[model samples]
Target: MPRLPPVDRLDLDDLVHRYAVLVDQRAFTAVGELFTPDAELVLPDPPTSLRPTVEVRGRDAVIGALGRLTGFAATFHAVVGRVADADPGDPDRATGRVACEAHHVSVDEDGRARDLTWYLHYDDAYARIDDRWLIARRALSVDVIATGPVRKVRADG
Candidate 1:
C-alpha cells in the first residue's frame, strides 16, 4: 500500500489529538463531530472498573457513551503516539493505532480521592467523507490499569 500523503497523515493525527482534548474537557457534544454518521466505538471488558464489553454504534451513541465520563471528578487523556496508513487500494480509507494514558479521578463521599489510570491503545478505521477524514471505527484496548490515592491541592492556596 502506498503511504498516506503528508497532509492526510497530519489530518489524521489532528483527529486523534482532538478526541483526547475534547474528552479531557468533557466536551462530549463537540467530540461527535470527529466521527462519521455511522461510526462505532468498541470498549474493552474486564478486571478494570470501566464498563465492560461495550460497543457504541453511530455518532449519537458514541457521544452518549462518552457522557458517562461525567462520573469522574476529572479526566485527562494524553495521546502518546500514533501511526496511520492509507488503504492499499483506496485513498479514502485508512487505519491507525493511537497509544494513550488516561487518568480518571474520582472523589468519595468521605472527601477522599483516587486516580485510576489506564495505559491503552485505540485501533481505528478512518474514512474520507466529502474531502474530510472522520473516524469510522475505534476499538480501545487497555494494556494496564494503575490505581492510587490522590490529594487535591488548591491553586489559590
Candidate 2:
C-alpha cells in the first residue's frame, strides 16, 4: 500500500477533529465548510426510537440538519480515535474509522430535563478538493447510548 504524504494525513486528521469542535461550539454553519458540495451523511436511528435512519445529501442539507442542534442547551463531541488509509489508486482520496462520544442536554416542553450520551463510530471517506481536505461520505453507527438523569415533575396544582 502506498503511503499518504505526511501533510495530507495531517490535514485529513485535522478535518476530522474540526467536526467535533464545530459541533460543540454550535458553529453548525461552519461545519458545512468541512465537506464537499455533494457530500453525504448517513446516521443510524437510535435504539427504541421511532425515527428512521437519517440520510442527508449535499452541503446545504448538512448545514440545515446540524444547525438544528441549536435546540440543545449544551452539547460536547469528543473524537477519541481514528484509523485512516489513503487510496493507492486515488492519492487524493482516503478512508477512515473514527470513534466518538457525544453528550447532549435538553429540556422538553413539559419542563422535564434529560442528559444523554451516545458512543458512536464513524466510517468516513475524505477527498481533496481545491487543495483542501473535505468529507465526501460519512456513516455513523451508534454503539451505545445512556439517557435520563431525568428531572421528574411532581403532580400538584
Best by lDDT: 1
lDDT of 1 at 89: 86
Q: What TM-score quantifies how close candidate 1 is to the native fold? A: 0.92
**After TM-score superposition, what is the CA distance of residue 29 in candidate 2 from its true location, in Å?**
1.5
- The residue-by-residue lDDT of candidate 2 on 100-133, one tens digit each, is 9887778788777687888888899999988999
Which stretch of 10 consecutive residues in model 2 shows the poorest summed lDDT? Answer: 148-157
TM-score of each: 0.92, 0.85
Please, what are the lDDT tens digits per residue for candidate 1 over residues 3-82?
89999999999999999999988889899989999999998875753433689899899999999898888888999999
Global lDDT of model 2: 0.82
Residue ranges of candidate 2 with Cα displaced over 4 Å: 48-52, 108-113, 148-157
Give the residue spans of candidate 1 off by over 4 A: 48-52, 153-157
Best by TM-score: 1
Residue 137 lDDT, candidate 1, scale 0-100: 95
lDDT score of residue 142 within candidate 2:
82
